[model samples]
Target: MGIHIIKMPDIGEGIAEVELVEWHVQPGDTVVEDQVLADVMTDKATVQVPSPVDGKVQALGGKVGEVMAVGSELIRLEVDGPGNAAAGAKQKRPVERTETAAQAEDATAPAPVQERGADAHVATPGPAQVPIKGQAGQVQPAQSQPQVQPAAGAGHAAARPAGEKPLASPAVRKRAWDLGIELQYVPGTGGGGQITHNDLDSYLARGAMGSAAAGRAAGYAPRDDEQAVSVIGLRRKIAEKMQESKRRIPHFTYVEEVDVTELDALRARLNAQWGAERGKLTILPLLARAMVLALRDFPQINARYDDEAGVVTRYGAVHLGIAAQTESGLMVPVLRHAETLDLWACAAEIARLADAARAGRAAREELSGSTITLTSLGALGGVVSTPVINHPEVAIVGVNRMVERPVILGGAVVARKMMNLSSSFDHRVVDGMHAAEFIQTIRGYLECPAMLFVE
Candidate 1:
């Protein structure tokens, strides 16, 4: 049998880097071309990396749950004879660590242990441990570990041997410091019993992670130079897109107040009867319906610029992207054909999309192809914030808090239902004047519910 090394396959997206989430087949296991070998995590989805050559699995790189860059070696195979590349026997397999480089990138990383906050000599956690093939490692849960107390709180720290090193990561050490937990007090369960994030989490959950830290390390002082931190996750993505929108698109913002008292009453009436289904009714559906109708009157917001084709693409139907606030990041899932759906249908779709986003189950298709977007911060008691336009299709609307306020009607001060509608459009295609008109168009529907019935 000739040795055939099976490098990582290009998944056709040409995108570099995928996270190694799981390994299905182990080395020495027989696999066929096209058999599923491992599952990889991309930015948008988790895809399975299949075998390209038929044979026995030879060498495998990296451990499961580690994020590996694309073009990196995933697995190697030993083929009996070269045959089909597209077809193979389906191979299902076991879980274990494969071979690796003798030296990892984080080699020499000292594990942090608290020896009365003395000199620490801990190696980097298991993720960056001795690299070897078929290494038998255990995922020792932190729960079994003793609570680690830090210098600030390690008043009774057990002395460590001069040559013995503690096991903990920099981040874990930082966390222990913050909580006054002395790592010296906490026994690690990592390979050679090292401290991991999970161990720290376990310690914290048990309320024994840390106590009073002695204080800041002696001779520690802040420097004049300040570190500028970049946002991460949802905030980072949001800031990048917002900055790009402001720089690329000439933005036009429009603000108007919608009198939603009648709509509110209708919602309350329906919710009372809906009970379980009534839980589905939110202000979002009504707002979506209003926006859909407004788009019908002012079609510019639903249009995209085709710079190369020299023709603007004005959409005949609305594909509304609902912005959901999730823990990891902001996800905007599109609801295609928003105009054709009724208010109830819109509410159901919004709930489904939001749930999918929250659960991290949002499909790639659910996130793309949005003609326009709706953002709701009303739940946070916010009012009248300008929303940056989501580019390409240049418009996004924001819903503010709903509250009762006195209004002057024909010189008569009376209470009127009030909610702010703030929308920003692309000045390139949707001019400021037209944008304001569009907001007013939505106001027209929100104020007069009869228009919805007629349309």
Candidate 2:
């Protein structure tokens, strides 16, 4: 019998370490070649590690949630015949020793030592070192490494007054300790309810710990009735991106009321004529078409600002991002080349993108590379919203709830369908006056629906 050591392999480009998410096998379990051994997570994606050769599992690389470096020992296995002879030969042969009472009789007698061999075992002096009985019924001493004692009050952040340790990997526990964050308050999203790095990050970002001081000053005790929800996966990604956008970009908002009475009439007529044949027409496509037309007048709004390069690139074609809320989280699916599509085509593309995003099947390309964004809350859109810019993009236009209100037209009171355009821009790149004018351009198109088809 021979032992084979399997090392962690390179999983992807620039992935030096991965967190062990799950293990499919344990010690002594027999596994075949190409069988899955564990599920590891890197770069927010989970990948399964498979065995290369058939063998009986001897030991696992590490516990779940442990971050293991690539090219390190991942698994050890016992296989038939000489397994990886080169590797096995490189292993150290244990040195053996024997003691005799006769030698002790002499005051200066030297201790008798046995020869080093493959069958020999190492020895060390310690109560923790236990003797292992070999196949020949000979007892062999095993060496044990010394354990480091932690200083007093160390890891107090993870300590609980209730005397319960949080379910987390050693690394996560150490990180929480360093940050003075109580793991009891940080929610876990891993299997068996273990805390992950993402959980720690989200907990910190929510300012749950920072609020403690203010609450105490106000004579408020910490609430024990609050439930801890783990922010992980897509939700975690959304939180990080939104936080980054808000932190890096200075946002300026402008709200304008548009009398969309004429635009609504045109959309209804088109839907009645070609809704079944092409696709159902919503206000989104009409808004998108108006924005596309308006972009021609103000091309600066349809561009990306690269803060790192200190430059802005404006595009003639509009790659519009339509924000759709799904079960997973909010996903913005891009409609490429919106400038080329007509009203009907835009509606069809929007429906297709929305369905794909909600079903979680949108391609990577469809989810990114938007020059500008348009978001709407449909029937639930309130009076106004200060929408955040989708970072790097200069502007984002939002559509609010359309309501019929009384307005005077040519000395007569008439009911008009009015909606507000709530838009936000990156103040660093766009001035307040220019941002206002851009919205007015969109307003003109919607107010005069015929102008959208002009050019």
Candidate 3:
């Protein structure tokens, strides 16, 4: 038999490392080519790694939640000689023969019996230790050390009742110990009642909450209960981007209230007419149209600032980013060339992009290369907001909730549909007065819907 080393494969664009989420096989298990070995998660997506050759598993790459770098040895397998003949051929023939002879000679030599250590047991090679078990009973490598039964009154044993150790990998046990958490009390979610990292985290979080509650009941100032969530994957990417934007770009915020009474009437009429033929129209498409029209007049807002190059490149086409919240987190899916699409087309494209983003099927191109961004919370949107500018882009427009408010129109009290437009600009690139004027332009188109259609 010859050994085969499987290295981690590149899963996606610019992915350097991935978190090992689950393993499907363990050492000594027979596997066929294309058999799934593990599921790994990157910032962009989750992918399964499959075995490349039929072989007997020898060892795994790492434990769950561990990050494995691309091109690193992921799995070691023992295969038939013929399957790995090319790899074996690289070894010097003489050296291989010599090593084989030495091993044979040692095997034939008398077995030297040695004294066992005070705490040692008979040593024998066994199936690899399962670090953790999944719902299907599949095991992962736990630790290199062999399992040893603890003696009565020994270290760690004296503190607890004697029994089989908790169903957990060595890594999980170590983490629990470090956090001073009792394993027995932590509920396990893995197969055969195995404790996972998530279980331990949940237990600790609950304990913190309990402690805080008890303190409060005793009339004492309760300690703050803080849950530490790992800033990784998509969340990590968002954090880095937001930090970079705030650090590099000086932001200037502008807020304006637009009396959208006339625009709302126009939108209702259009949706009534085209709602059956095309997709239903929302305020977003109309707002996007207004923004596009406004961009035509003030092209500075539709530009990217290259801080390093010390120049701004403006685009005639608007690659609009619409921020949508998904189950995972916030995602901004771009609607490329928004200026070319009319209101109904804009609505259709917006629906398509939002669906793709929420379903986690958005392409990398669709998720990036936005010249400007528009954010709205619909009913949740308050009267006004100070939105953060999408990095590299000069501005972001926020749409607030539309509400009926009493206003003086031509010296008469009338109820009007009013909404606030909150916008933020890169102060370094745009002056405060210029930023206000850009918002004013957008407001004019929205208030006078016909202006949006005018060439």
Best by TM-score: 3
Report the number of clashing residue pairs per model: 13, 0, 2
Poorest stretch of ten by lDDT in candidate 2: 105-114
User: What are the runs in model 2 whose C-alpha is more than 4 Å off?
Assistant: 1-224
- Cα TM-score of candidate 1: 0.61
Q: Write the per-residue lDDT of candidate 2 for residues 46-126, one digit (tens) a residue.
A: 567899899988767665545679987777778887886443444222111113112222211111112334443222111
Candidate 3, residue 260: lDDT: 97
TM-score for each prediction? 0.61, 0.58, 0.65
**How many collisions between residues are there in candidate 3?**
2
Displacement of residue 401 (Cα, Å) in model 3 is 1.3
Quickly count the clashes in candidate 1: 13
Q: Once model 3 is optimally superposed onto the true structure by TM-score, how far is the C-alpha of residue 301 displaced, in angstroms?
A: 1.3
Write one digit per residue (lDDT tens) for candidate 1, span 53-155. 7788765676664556666667667777653332343322322344322132233344333343232232322222321112122222121122232434233
Off by over 4 Å in 1: 1-74, 77-244, 275-279, 308-310, 406-417
Candidate 1 local distance difference test against the native: 0.66
